[model samples]
Target: MEHRGFTALGGDCELFRIDLGGGTLAEGEAWVRQMHDRFTRFSESSELSQFNASAGDWVEVSAEMDALLRESLRAFDVSDGLVHAATLPALLAAGYTRDFSLGSTPTAMPPPPPRPLPELLSVRDGKARLAAGAAIDLGGIAKGWMADRLAERLGDNCLVNLCGDLFARGSGETGEGWPVGFGDRSVLLKDMAAATSGVTKRMWGPGLHHLIDPRTSRPAQTDLHEVSVLAATATDAEIYAKVALLKGSADAAKWLEGRAMGWSFV
Candidate 1:
């Protein structure tokens, strides 16, 4: 068994492998840093930043960018437009302009109303475009997507954890499953993914957090503080958890029924 831990994408990251046969933990860490540099909106030189800057014009994109863009569109459809990626403006308006770990002082300002993602973004022929005023922050989607990618690259038996979003591939040393800490107990997961979404961790002020409700274009006001979900992929888990949290306690269970393999709410 081997383990590596570090920080990237504004959160703690970890990689684990059993009887390594594929990529090394060092290489996996490097790959994560590379992806963070490419996708992060904080860096002015990042591809995502460049894309955001090039709004209103079609810009060439790499294969990874194209895939993620398409995944963002799918998330929009899966969550019934609740898990929007084009909420950068709204996030900024909510005073999350910088990484939450670095602390930001948010001013009292209302964000612009949400716009339909499909209408503002389009992709074709290895190129993509966003409307003039439209910008996107991949956020949790990118983390989950990267985790799944890293898991594939790491080995047949490995786990990739980026913050609370993670992917577990293959069985663990015990051959049962990879033991993971959930709510109050440990659950063994094999060839599956888990993600937790919450407002408590990122809150900076009253009613200020990273989770933006696309319906109102503001921080969500929900009865539930957090939600964790299991799915076939980390990306799917992330989308499900966010949607459940946004749906609040009363309606979350019904919406999450049959959508997730397992779920817990707080």
Candidate 2:
């Protein structure tokens, strides 16, 4: 059986089951909604939004939030700061203050200045301190994280695809693997996640989208429009995809040589 949904995480989402056993499909939906509510920056009441609003102050966060933030830091490190979570101001400057699913908003705002990683985050003891005048948007990592989390609840015969980030459990009905496709390639994945990032999607202004270059605090001028990476988890794949796109085709290939990653770029 399969189910599809839209308007969650500002993109299409789906769940597929094949002899599933661990958790009910409804439970998956509930978890998605809950995470969406907590992480979405479009709402003022969201935990992320509250954190963004509370700049220069230490705010307590739940375990999920702490984990997510730590993952963001890891993404920052792995990508060499090419991808980051604290890009709310940059996104707003690029005219992405509203949800892209509702269509684009073309208002003008000041672009965020480049910031060091230490200036972006200070997390300890289940609390985080956002630098003054800095804001964060977890949209980049949150969807992939949600995909990984949802995949854990399913039995050993299911697939979770949330906003193009995916996690599959066990092999498909044929026991080969679940096939996932992206630029110039298709991967048969079982008990793994695949995430693809693209600059072409979520366009707002002349050159703006969800992906931001931390150095310039604007849409990265990447040679590849899209890049896909397969990894053990969706968040890692998502981070790799973005980093690969930003590094272009050649460097991405070199970076993937020693890593257990399969990538396709265009």
Candidate 3:
């Protein structure tokens, strides 16, 4: 039997769904919608936004958010704070706050003031908590996590593509790996998720891009066009790809060598 999945992820376009020749797509779609409903800030009642909007010493969140934040923290240290959601304000300060569809170029107005890092953001009691006034942007890893969730909800016979950050289970009918290309450019194909991070055309200005270095509080100074990694988990591939791109190829290669994670740089 075949199934369908669909939802809107709140970043670029609505993350609508399309299922082909599948049965029980509604169950899968409903589960996917549940995820979207729980996560989308536009919904006005998402747990994340509620927590961010709430007034308390520490607003707590669900287990999923806790787990993902913990994973992100590990990535932060492993990548030397190069792959962090906490850097979103830095990104916006560098003229990257606009919607993705507006294109990848910076606006004419001066960039916003630099945003300070959170005083405390930690997981406690199986809940993710943020300090009273620390805003976060999970755009870096949320999509991959959603893809993972959808893949888990569905059996291992399909592919999950959240705006081209894709994850697949099992082989295609042709017995060949699912073809994944980066940035809607290039002819390369692989079985794993491929995430492309650059100052995308939308965030380019004064030789600056959205991807910032949390340690230095500036755009990362890396001589890499893109970085791609292959791993058992799509979340891993996404996180690694972003971290590698920020780390640049040299440091990334060293980091991967330490972890023994399969990767490629272009």
Candidate 4:
């Protein structure tokens, strides 16, 4: 087996293609291109983008989007609503709204006094409802979901990486499973997705960053710098990471233990 890597789906995506029994490079490229055309949010016709823009009623969806949202919502419910996309405006108002840039001068943004949680959450007819004053930003689960889908599409012998997080389906020709490293943290994965969430990588304020504690409806005051969770799916890992970060190390560990999910905090 030979491994071929390429950038596709979008400029931000990275994919690895493994040729079982030594297939042509062109064939692998074509397969990747097809997957990107179907999966990338920029594809315009993807069911996800359509759903992202839909409002007011249950937007009828294909089975794929339906499954994605359904499973993602499980994370929402489990985190006690801590990890939510409807709070985008609140996140921005706290100074995390800007594109992440290193070495930039920190702004003198005032601390946003605590505000009431927006009434933008509700579920009806088996679908999540976005309240009149809420917005849906799927940055939390979108990438992980895409990686999971790509792993499924590639079957039992490939790896999929979205930005930094990675999910793998099987080992390569070297008889080693997918090995992914982020900064100083590296891990092996086999049919699993590892998602990381933290405030260390985001902009800093007086004592706050992007990770907000939705439990108190404020920026999380947890002292831990980072937290990573391992679960059956990337969506689970992603949600657990955020939930753990907001809940703090002890509470996060207890929560994961109760749920039987793997986690690490630093």
Of the candidates shown, which would achieve the greatest TM-score relative to the real structure?
1
lDDT of 2 by residue, 1-266 (tens): 65545547777788887865768777888889999999888899999989988989999998889988888888888878877777778778777778777876665655756576667798898999888888877876888888888887877788899888998888987799988776666778888888888888776666766677777777777778888888889988888888888888768888766553677777
Q: Tens-digit lDDT track for model 1 on 58-156?
A: 999999899899989999999999999998888888888776777876565666776889998898879999999889998899999999999999889
Residue pairs with clashing backbones, model 2? none
TM-score of 2: 0.92
- Write candidate 4's Cα lDDT for 9-105 as tens digits: 3334555657443335455456556644544444347554454455445555545545555555666667777776555545555665434543323
Cα misplacement distance, residue 18 of candidate 1 (Å): 0.8
For candidate 1, the clash count comes to 0
lDDT at residue 37 of model 1 (Cα atoms): 90
Candidate 1 differs from the real structure by a C-alpha RMSD in angstroms, to one decimal, of: 1.1
TM-score for each model? 0.97, 0.92, 0.73, 0.70
Better of 1 and 4 by TM-score: 1
Rate residue 84 of model 3 by lDDT. 65
By lDDT, the candidates rank as: 1, 2, 4, 3
Model 4 error, position 103 (Å): 11
